[model samples]
Structures are given as C-alpha cells and as structure tokens.
Target chain A: MRVLITSGGTTERIDDVRGISNFATGSLGKITAEQFLQAGHEVFLLASETAILPEAAENLTIIHITTTDSLVKNMEKLVPEVDAVVHTMAVSDYQPVFMTALSNFSDDFSKDDLLHFSAEKVRKISSNSDFQLMLLKKTPKVISYIKKWNPQVQLFGFKLLAGVSEQELVDVAQKSLVKNQADFIIANDLENITKTQHEALLISFDRIVKMHTKLEIAQSILEKAQEAYHG
Target chain B: MRVLITSGGTTERIDDVRGISNFATGSLGKITAEQFLQAGHEVFLLASETAILPEAAENLTIIHITTTDSLVKNMEKLVPEVDAVVHTMAVSDYQPVFMTALSNFSDDFSKDDLLHFSAEKVRKISSNSDFQLMLLKKTPKVISYIKKWNPQVQLFGFKLLAGVSEQELVDVAQKSLVKNQADFIIANDLENITKTQHEALLISFDRIVKMHTKLEIAQSILEKAQEAYHG
Candidate 1:
C-alpha cells in the first residue's frame, strides 16, 4: 500500500523569536510510519519541524513541512496517488494572513520612536503564518481537502478532548467519523497519553476495540489496510 | 508552594533491546509544571528518559528516573517536604521477573548436533533468585503516600478515559474523586489529546469547563490552586 503520514506540530510564529506549537514529540507518527514500513508497505511522511524522525526506512519518502499552505500544496500533489493517508500532525489552525518583508526585520532597533505612516500592509507570506496574535485566519481543514482531492482514498483524522467521559469520547468520535468521513478514529485517554504509557480504544462505525500498545494499534491498522485493499 | 511533578513514560527493560512503554509523550505533566512555575511555585521534576525536556521553570529541580523502585525511593524522600505532589509519570506497572547473568549467556555452536539440556541443568541455571524473572510489584500510589505523609496537604489526581461520553467522564471523575480522595481530578479524552492542539476540558467535583488552549488550562489550574489556598 502507498501509505502517507504527517507528524509533528506546525509552529505559527508570533515574532522571529517566538511562536505557537503543540505539546508533542512526534513519537506516534514516527513509530506508525516505521510500523507500516515493517509491514512491507511503501510510506510517504510529511513532518513538521519539531517531530522526531523515526528510524530510516528503505522504502519511505520524507517531506519537511512548516505551514498549512505548504501542507495543502504538497497534499495537492501527493494525496492523489496514495492508497491511505493518516493525518497526525497538529496543524496551526490560525495563522497570520501575511508576513513582513525580510528587510523590515531589524538587526538593531532605535530606542527612540520613529515616524510612521499607515498604508495597507497585505501580502501572502505563508512562512510565519502559523502563529499571529491579532489578525489571524482559520486554516483550511486538511481533511476537508483530502476528501475533496481523492474520493476513493481512505483518510483518517484525529480528535482530542480534555476531561470528558468514555461515552463522551464515543459520541465525539462518531461525530468526527461522520463529519470528516474518516474510516476510523482512535479515541484516547489524555491522562495516559501525556503522562506515560496507557491503552487506546479504536472506535469505528460499528464496533470498538481496546489496544494496549502502539504496536498493537499499528498492526491492527496494517491489517485493516490489507482488508481494504483486497476487497 | 513547593511542588514536584513527574512526567513521561518509563521504559521497563525486558531484555537488552526490548522494553515496555506507552503512547504518552509527557505534555500534560510538563504543561502543568509550567503553569505551577508561572504561578510562582518552586518545582522539582522527575522525568522519564525521553527526548523532550520538562517545561522551563525558574524555580525547578530535575531528576531523571528509570525504574519503579527508583521512583518510589525518590518520592519517599521528597514527598515529606513539598506542599503538593503531582505524580504524573506513567511508571511501568510491571517489570522483568529476572535478569540474565552475562557469564551464563553463552552462544557456542550447537548446529551440528541436536541441542539438548537436562531438566536439572535448566533448573540449576534458572534458579538464581535475583536473576530469576523479577516479579514486578505494583508501585505505591503517589496520592496514597501523599495523604499518609501529610494529611493537611492538598492532593489532586487525574483519571483519563477513552471511548466514553462527557457524562461518563463526569461519572468516572466523581468515582475517582471519592475513591482516590483526590481534591480534584482532571478527567479528559485521550484520542483528542496529543494531536488536538486547542481543545481541553477540566472536570472538578461540581463542574466541567472547556478551555481552548493549553495556557487557559494552566490558568484554570492556578485559579483552583489559589482558591484552595485561600479557602
């Protein structure tokens, strides 16, 4: 199978020195990619800056991504060919509409105030669009694009919640499934996810199964892919 | 207040190359620690061996931990003085029953003839109690120790669930509140955690509030801590 996976949290720069990113280390997407490779499937990976690189695979292609626009651009080209795409990266949902020209960035600033004239400052600077404080726009939901780009390709998306119960997860997962047209959504318990090792529940349309380890989850996904392919 | 927070999953070695771990990346614990520090609390952190560091804190002590025994040992000593203890690390619930002695690990050639070992020989070699599969004893519950060590100190714990509804989360959180005697339990959805960047909810005894960013969650925690301190 031609499997494509995205990992890591995209950073939206508030300024040159600071930005917004997610609380992630990129272990899931990295390991999931490796697991797919181990199962003898071709893999394509688009990684944000902060995600850890999984062990190199002989049949895997890696793409470095920094913004939602770039991601959309790459997916425009790659999503058509792959059999499955696992959308794991936390894309910055809000970004600045544009960036300042490089020349406007100062090496040394004057302590005293300088005269300013107001002219409309607008342009497409997708570079630092990930993090902006005041004038930000809701990013294109990548999953929406996947469904639009390739109707036949199997697409999976992730959802997270804090302090909701098991029944709440199923409701949310089901909603996400129908809303995004995802084949399956892996519902997780946050306490176990961020603190240490915990189990995960795979919620599909008809059934739910608990998997205790990442390997177990990956293997199940691989088997599901095989089923999807053979039929 | 002085505090200690542990984050991330510990790898329990089963052999030279294999070990057991979980999907957790240590974000929540780290975020909490950052919030506590932001509130001007002195913090000490015991972190699992992973690539990510604990959130930056001005008043913080960091201890790298590997085994369940070591975690208990460290806490037994430190739990006495801190005003609050947040045990967030996903310590392995089990460990290898035995360790193989290096001298006994011989790989001499035996392909030419049938490989055989007498029952007595096998028993003799395997009976070393220290090297015998070390049956893992469950680690002491951190809250139990906290309550025991300092009855007056405020205590908190988390209960995470997957594939459950919001009502289930509240039910689970309430049960945990009574059973664990926790001052508060931040019940949460896991599938929505590591990947979802913006949405988080907090469940206390009387209410559930959804927060849009990690910063807001930290702010809520700080407010709760202050309320507890003042009340």
Candidate 2:
C-alpha cells in the first residue's frame, strides 16, 4: 500500500526567534509510520522540525517541511500516488498575517514598530472560497484537498475533544466522517492519556478495541489497514 | 508539607518467566511529585521497578520499593508524618492466590495435566479480619485505607478507564470519589490520546478543563497542590 503520514506541528514563523507551534512531539505519527513500514506498506512521512527523531525503517521515506503552505504543496505532489493518507500532524491554524523580509526581521519582540504589517499572511492562507475566518480561520482541511485529487484513496482523520462526554465523542466522530468525507475517524479523548504511555481505545464503525501499549495500537492500525485493503 | 506519592505498577510473579503487571509508567505520579516539589512541598516517592529515571527535584525524597506488601510496610512506617498522600500506583489487584518460592518451583506446562501448586510464600502477611480472600474479591481501595489511618491528611486517588464516554466518566469519577473517600480524583481516559503528545481533559469538581501540553498539565497540578496546601 502506498501510505503517506504527516507528523509534528508546522511552525508558522512570527519572527526570527519565535513562531506559533502546537505542542506536539510527533510520537503518534512516528509510531504509525513504523508500523505501516513493518507491514510491508510503502510509507512517506511529512515531518516537521521537532525534538523527536524519525524512526529508521527500510521502506519509509521522510520529508522535513516547516510550514503548512509547504506541506500542502508537498501533499499535492504526493497525494495522487498514495493509496492511503493519515493526517496526524497538528498544523498551526494560522501564521503571522504578513511576512517580513528575512534581512529586516528582528529576533526581539520589542522592536516591532518598523513595518506596518497587514494580516495578509493570516487572511490569504485562510481565504479559501469555501471556508471563512470568523475569530480564527480554519486551516484548509488537508483531507478535503487530498480527496479532491484522489477520491478513491482511504483517508483517516482525527478529532480531539475536551470537556465533552464519551457519547459526544462518538457523535462528533460520526459527524466528522460526513463533514470531512473521511473513510474513518479516530475520536481521541485529548484529556485522558499523554505521550508518555498508557492503554488506548480504537473506535470504529463495527466496534471499539482496547490496546494496552503504543505498539499494540500501531499493530491494530496495521490490521485495520489490511482489512481496508483486502475488503 | 510532607507528601508521600506512590506510582507505577507493582509486578506479581506468576512463575519464573511470567507475571502480572498493570501498565503504569509512574509518569503521572512522578509529574505529581515534581509538581509538589516545585510548589515548596516536600515529597517522598515510593516508585516501582521501571527503567525510566525519576526526575530530580530538590524537595523530593526518593524511595524505591517493590511489591504491594513492601509498599504497605513503607507506608506504615512513613504515613504518620506526611501531610498528604497521593496513591497513584497501579498496585496489583491480586497476588497469585498462592506465591511459590523459586527453590521449590517447577515449570512444566502440559495442557492435559493441569496442576495447581500450593506454597508457603502465599501465606497471609497480616492478621486483619477485613483482609479475607473472599472469592471474586475486589482489590481494597487504597485511598480508603489511608483515610482510615490519617483522617486529617488530604488524599488524592487516580482512576483509569478505557472506552468510557465523557458523561460516564464524570459519573464514575464522582462515584469513585465518594467510594474511595478521596478528597479529589485524577480520572484518566486510557483509551483516548494514548500516544499523542498533546490533548487531555482535567475534570475537577465544577468544570472539565482542556489541557493541550504536558507543561500546562503539570503546572495545573502544581497549582492545585498549592491551593490544597494554602487553603
């Protein structure tokens, strides 16, 4: 299977020293890539700059990209060839609305009175004809773009929720399946487990399966992939 | 304040090669210990056998011990002086109905000839009328045991669940709080966000707050500890 996975958070540079980054370690993305490779699937990872080292797998290809705009560019180039895509990266919802010339950029936040920057970097990236920017514009849903290119490719999307109950999670997951036009949705309780380690649950259409370890969860994903491929 | 925190899973030997262990990394407990120390509260950690190193903090007093019985012994010796206790360890719910000594044990597994071995190592350690191994016995809740010893000392307990919905979790948390007599409960959703770096929900008395980073969660826990101590 030709599988493409995205890991880590894309950095939307605010300045030379600082940028917007979602606090993510890319653990899930790395594990998914490892498992997919082990199962003899061709895997390509769209990774972001982070502390985690990508696992060295014989059949896996890693691409390091910094911004969501670049990620989308790479995805447009790769999505047509892949049979399945796992959208796991926590892409920043917005970048600075404008970009400064690299030569004139300042590392210190105090010296920001020079350039009168309009919020174009923020508005232009979010100004898709279909989506709107209310308080915060939604980053273009990568899955929708992928579907536009290759409608038959299997796509899995994730939903993380807090302060909501389990029934709501399943409801949200089901709703996301339709809203996002995804083949399957993994509804994660962002509040329960952390990257450290713990048991996990996989909620799918037929049933919910319990996985005790990270490896176990990855293996389950592999098995599900097999079912998807063979079915 | 002097605080005693127990964490990780206690492994009970099933035989020479196999055993039972709850999948706990002691991450939550260690983080709690780290939080306590950061808030100027003195902490003593009774950790289980895991390769991960305990984080160093100036206010922490690290104590390593194995087995539930040993942990109980340590608690008996130290609980008198501590200001609060957090029972976060995934202590074994059952010891081998009989513990076998290595010198007298034999490992021969033949499905046709099932043999049950009775050994002296399984003898009851303490004489308490309440400590009967009634068939299908539920593990004694640790917080209640600590409460019996020190009614004035604040105690927190942890509960882990898989595939439980959010509304169910709240009800379960409240019931556990009353049943365990815990001043507060750290209820974790084991199935969701198992390997993800960010995403977690903090369920308190009146609100379920969403936390997206380890640092934020750790800080929130520390703040809670400070509130508990100062109030």
Candidate 3:
C-alpha cells in the first residue's frame, strides 16, 4: 500500500522570525512510517522540519513542512495517490488576527485605542514600552478537508487531551471520528504521555481497541490499515 | 568567575493542553555555558526544559525552567551568588488571557451576545463553530528585573530583532542596555541567524565590538566576564 503520514507540529508565523508552535517530537509518526515500510509499504512522510527522525530508508520519502498552509498544500497534492493516511500532526487552530497600528501620543492613551492591533503586533509594541491589545482569528479545520480531497482513502486521526478522564477521552475521540469521517481515531491523555509506560485507545465505529506502548500502537495501526485495504 | 547563563525559549500556557512558545533552541546558551566551564568558571545554567544541551560537566549545574515566572524565581534565588550573568533565554513577553466558558448557547445565538465574553472566551467559542474575538495581555518584562534583584553582578543581555537594519539593531540593543542597566548587550538580526555564518554586535556604554560566529561571540562574552570580575 502507498501511505501518506504527517508528523510533528505545524507552526504559525507571528513575524518573519518568530512563530507559535507546539512540542510535538514527531516520534510517533516517524515510528509508524518506519513500521509501515518494514511491512512492505511505500511511505511518504510529511514531517515538520524540527521533528526528529531516524536514518533514511529506501522505501520512505520525507518532505519537511513548517506551516499549516504548507501542510495542507502538500496533503492536497499527495492524498489522491496514496492508499491511506495516518495524520499525527498537531495543526494550530488559530492564527494571529491582523490589526492596524495606532499612532498617538499621551500618557493616557485609552485601552480602547490599543485594541486595534493583534496579539502579535501588541508583542512588537510591548518591546518598545508601548502596551497594546491583541486579537486572534480561527484557522480552518484541516482534518475536515481530507475526505473532500480523497473520499476513498482510509483516514486515521490522532486526538490528544490533557487532564481528561478515560471516558472523556473516548467521547472526544469518537466525536472526532464522526466529524472527520475517519476510519479510526487514536486517543491519548497528556498526563499518561509523560510517563515511561503509555497507553492509547484506537476508536472505530463499532469497537475500541486498547494498546500499550507507542511501538505496539504503531503496529496495531498498520494491521488495521492492511485490513482496511484488503477487506 | 561564578557565572549564570540562561538559554532557550520560555512557554506561556494558553490552556490546560496548549501553550505559546518561541523557536529558541538554546544552542547559543548551551555553547556559552560550555565555554564558561572550559574557561574554569563554575557555571549555573538556567535553561528551558525544551532547550538542547551538551554533555554533563562537573563544573556545571543545570536548572530546567518552563515559564517566565519560573525563570524569575530561579534568577531571584541564584543572582546574588553569581559573579556575572549571560541571559540568552528568549522569555515570552505575553501570556494568553484565559476566559471562562459561556454556557446555554442556542443554534440561533447572535454574534452580539458572544461579544459579552472576553477575547480569550471568544477563542474558546470559535473552537465550537461560534467565531468570537481574542485579546492578549502583556507579560511582565523579565530583563528589567535583573538589576533590581542583584545590583553588582555584571549583566549581559541579548536582543534579537527580525528584518531590522544594522543601525536599528544597535539602537535597540543600546536602549536595552540603558533600560536594564546592563553592562553589555549582544544584538543580532534574525535574517542573519539562518545563514551558515552569523554576526553580532556587543554594545556597551563605551563601545560596540562586532563578532563573526557564535563561538567567537561566546568567547568574547566570557572575556568580558573575566575583565568585569578582575577589573
């Protein structure tokens, strides 16, 4: 099977130099891609530039992406040719809301006057001793576009929740599966992620499968992909 | 000299699960700490947990910190004991303004009704399909507290400006030196940072010395510390 896997976290640029990003190591996706290749599958890995990966392999191809838009563009271009997708990338859901700079002078510049700029612009202003207000805008839902681009390709999504109970974790994962029309959703809590031993649940429409260790989860995901392809 | 150095970027929590952080790798700080140790100085490295570091040394002690508040707390405890401070950490200047969730929303909820909540509240709202506003509040300036905490320590601050000309970079660095009562300020442009080679200006009250590589900059900073300690 030809598979497309995205790993790591996407960054949203606040300026030419700085950006907002998450702490995803892309280890999960990298391991999963390696597992798929060891199982005799061709892999295209769309990974964040900062994500760490093992040494190169013959059956694997890697494309480094930095931002959410770039990830979308690559996915749109590559999804049609792949047989399945395992998207483990944490895409930013909000972009800095752009706002115009306000120019004025006075000890009493109203808070109302400062609300004109974005949190990003306010950060720039704060460096110069000027306190300003900032705003944010929501980014488009990237997962919802997958089926639009490739309806037949089997899709597996990842949902990470922090400080949530197991029931809440499963509930959210199930909602995500239905919303994205995904074949399976991998659910994990952040608290468990910090421990040496970790567990995750693979939620499909009819049942939930629990797996221990990231390597075991990756193997289970591959097995499900094979079933998806040959079923 | 007993030297204290800070490296990497601080993170500000946006919610229970997410945060705002910069792209600081702490490479510069790690290298500088190693250089200090090589110069026979006892070093205290206050670094972000995400920052990379070199192999362990007997003369070095590493304190891992995450947020600006944690950085401040560490500095307050260690500043008076150190002979010099090389603060290279990219401390976040803003934290996400958290908001309470609004309940009892209907399908016909008007946009005006949502405006009653804060921008932080709006960001939470936007996640569920009701687009709303976001606001940011400025974080306390961490550098400004250095002199207040320890008056006699020879302090070196770092200033990183993106897409700025040499004159602008120097001006900002010089201003930072005056504002913080810093002994010296190392200024660098972000555009030059991505290149194979990098350059920085050491701006003090009396003179500006330009250095060509990170290693050279680290060496120069150490020399300044030695001079301040002995002079």
Candidate 4:
C-alpha cells in the first residue's frame, strides 16, 4: 500500500519577518512513516519544513510544507495517488488578512482607524513599533477536503485536546471521524503528552485501541492501516 | 573573558497551543558560541527553547527561555556577571492581550466588542472557529534594557532587515547600536542569507568589518568581543 503521512505544525505568515505556528513537532509521524517503510510500503511524507523526518529511503518521498496554502496544494496533489493518509500535521486555523499597528489597547480606539495599511510583505513597520492588531480569517477545513478530494482513500485523523476528560476526547474524536469520513481517529490528550509518554486512544467506528508510547502507537497504526488495506 | 550570548527567536503566545514567532533558527548563534568556546571563553547562552543549541560543555551554561518576559528576566539576571553580551535572539515586538471570534471581517464591527475575555492560558475556543481578532500590545525594547541592566558590559547585537539597501540596514543598525549602547552591531540582510552564505557587516562606532559566511561572521564577532574585553 502507498501512504501519505503528514507531520508537524503549519505556520501562517504574519509578515515577511513574523508568523504564527502551532507546537506539533511531527516526531510520531516520523516514527510512523519509518514503520510503513519497514513493511515495504511506498511512503509520501508530507511534513512541515521544521518537522522531524525519517531518513531518506528508496520507498520514501518527502514533501516539506509550511503554510496552510502549501499544505492544501500538496495534499490535493498526493491524496489521489496514495492509498491512505495519516494526517498528523497541526494545520493553522486562521490566515492573516492584514496587520495594523495600534497606538494603545485603549477602549477609545476607533474601528475605522483599525486596518492601518497592511503591507505587501516587507512589513517595514520599523523596529520602533509599539502596539498592533492582526485580523485573521478562518482557513478552510483542511481535513474535510481530503475525502472530497479522494473518497476511497483511508484516513487516520489525529485530534489533540488539553484539559479534557478521556470520554470527552474520545467523543470529540468520534464525531470528527464521522464528520470527516475517516477510517480511524487518534484521540490525544495534551496533558498526557511528554518527551517519554504519548498516551492516545485509537478509535474506529466500533473499536478502541489504547497506545501508551509513540513506538506502540506507530506500530499499531501501521498494522491497523495495513489490515484495512488488505481486508 | 566571560561572555553572555542570546540566541533563536522568542515566541509570544496567542493561546496555549498557538503562538507568534520569528524565523531565526539560532544556527549562527550556535556557531558563534562554539568559536567562543574553542577560544577558551566561559559562555552563558540564553536561548529560545526552540533554538538550535550548542552541545553542553563544562564552561558553557545554557538557559532555555520562551517568551519575551522570560528573555527579559534572564537577561537582567545574567548581564551584570558577564563581561560582554552577544544578543542574536529575534524577540517578539508585540504580545497578545485577548482574542475574539469574528463572524466576519466586515468593518461593521464594534470596538466595544473588541476584547473578548483573555483566557487564563487554556484557550478552549472550539475548533470550529470562523474568524479571530488578536490585540497585541508592544513589548518593551529588550536591547535597550540590556545596557541599563549592566552599564559596563560590552554588547554585540544582531539586526536583520529584508528588502532594504545595504546603507539603510547599516544606518538602522548604527542607530540601534548607539541607542542600546552596544559595542558592536551585526547588520544582516535577509536576502543574502542562505544555507551557504550569511553576508553581514559588523558595525562599531568607527569601524565596519564585512563577513560573507556564518563561520567568518562567528570568528569576527568572537575576535571583536575578545579585543574589547582585553582592551
């Protein structure tokens, strides 16, 4: 089977010099990609430019992505060719419309005076700037577009929630799985994640498999995806 | 001589999971620190947690910091003890006050509705958000405060500017150097920097040294600081 695995976090440009990015390191995705390659599967690793990567191999193709725009383009290009997608990339929720420097955070500030001229890209707002406002527009749902792009491709979605109950995380994961028409959902608790531990619940439509470590999770995911592809 | 070095890019939190950061990799700083260490200097490296770091050594003390607040705190504590400071860290200019979900980016919005409650770290906004406006107040000038922290400490500052003339870059760096009371400022062009090349001008009050590579830049900076310390 061919797999397109995404890892790490997407960054939305605030300007040529600055950006907003999430905190996904793509370590697990790198590990998962390795497991697939060991099983002799063709792997297209769609990863953040800053993500941890599996070593280059004959069966492994790496596509480094940055913003949500780049991610959309790459996923659209690869989703049709691959048999499955393990999307671990934490894609940004918003894209910048414009950024304006503010004088203060005072309540008396006028909305008409808000935009303050968004730059082309240079954002030469001087190193001497004080206060600012950034207007971010919601990006399209990147995951939902996967099934729409390739309905037959199996999808394994990962959801990270912090300070939430076990049941709540799973329920949210379940809903997301159904909504996205995914074959599996990995419900991850942010609180439980550390350098050593990455406890997660692998939920299918009918079953839940518990994973305690990143290695365990990677092996299980690789196996489950293989089972579905061959079954 | 004892030298304090700041490296990488500081992150300003938008929420618990999301943040705004700059593009510095801390690669140059790491290279510079190694040069200093090879020259038998005691190095105090205050770095962004995400930065590329020098390997641990008995003479090297590493302090990993995240936000602008942490950077300020660390600089204040370490400045008085060190003989010189090489500040290469890309600190954030603004910090988030609060974020509100916008139905749309229409100008019909009200400033009265501008500040949605600043969450206590856990930003539990639904994943189904449409739009958001983040108000960011300017952080205090970190470099200016450094000299105030320790009046006698020789300072080597790094300034990055994109899409600007060489003269403009130097002029700004010169102003920053004078304003911050830095002994030397490395004026860097964003366009000239790549994996192999790192064109920079090391500017002091009366002299400028041109450097064309990261290693060359590192060597020059180390020598200049050593000269100042010995003189």
Q: Report the first chain's TM-score for all candidates.
A: 0.80, 0.77, 0.88, 0.92
TM-score of each: 0.45, 0.43, 0.83, 0.91
**Model 3: per-residue Cα lDDT over B1-231, one tens digit each:** 899999998887665544667668888998899899998999999988768886799999999998888999999999989899999999886665542322333433333333343443221222553232333456787888888889999999999876678999889998899999999999997767743566899999999999988888899999999998999
Candidate 1: TM-score? 0.45
Shares of reference contacts reproduced by the candidates, in order, are 0.00, 0.00, 0.26, 0.68
Per-residue lDDT of B134-204 in model 4, one digit per residue for the tens? 77778887989888989989888888887789999889889988898988999997888889999999999
Residue B94 Cα positional deviation in candidate 1, in Å, after optimal superposition: 43
Give the worst 10-residue stretch by lDDT in candidate 4 chain A: A102-111
CA lDDT of every candidate: 0.62, 0.61, 0.78, 0.85
Let me know the DockQ for model 4. Answer: 0.51
Off by over 4 Å in 3: A99-132, A162-175, B99-126, B130-132, B163-168
Q: Write the per-residue lDDT of candidate 1 for residues A1-231, one digit (tens) a residue.
A: 898898876655533322334445667788789888988899999997557888777899999986678888998899999998888786765553332322332433221111121223432122222121122345677877887788788876766555568888789889888888888787765544643464677778998877777667667677777788778
Cα-lDDT of candidate 2:
0.61
Candidate 2 lDDT over residue span B1-231, tens digit each: 888889876655433222334556677677777777776789889887551335787777777765577788788777777878877787755444432222232233221111233434421122212111111112344556787777767766765555567777677777767776767666665555444453455565666666665455666656665677779
Model 2 misplaced regions, further than 4 Å: A98-137, A196-201, A205-207, A210-213, B1-231
Ranking by lDDT: 4, 3, 1, 2
Two-chain DockQ for model 2: 0.01
Q: Can you write out model 2's per-residue Cα lDDT over A43-84, one digit (the tens) per residue?
A: 989987552545677788889977778899999999899888
User: Which tens-of-lDDT digit does each residue in A1-231 have in candidate 4?
Assistant: 999999999999987777989878889989999999999999999888778999989999998898999999999999999899998889888888777755444445444545454444555445455556777778878899999999989999988887899999889999999899999999988788899999999999999999999999999889998898998
Clash count of each predicted structure: 30, 10, 2, 0
Q: Each candidate: RMSD to true structure?
A: 25.2, 23.8, 4.8, 2.9
The CAPRI class of candidate 1 is incorrect
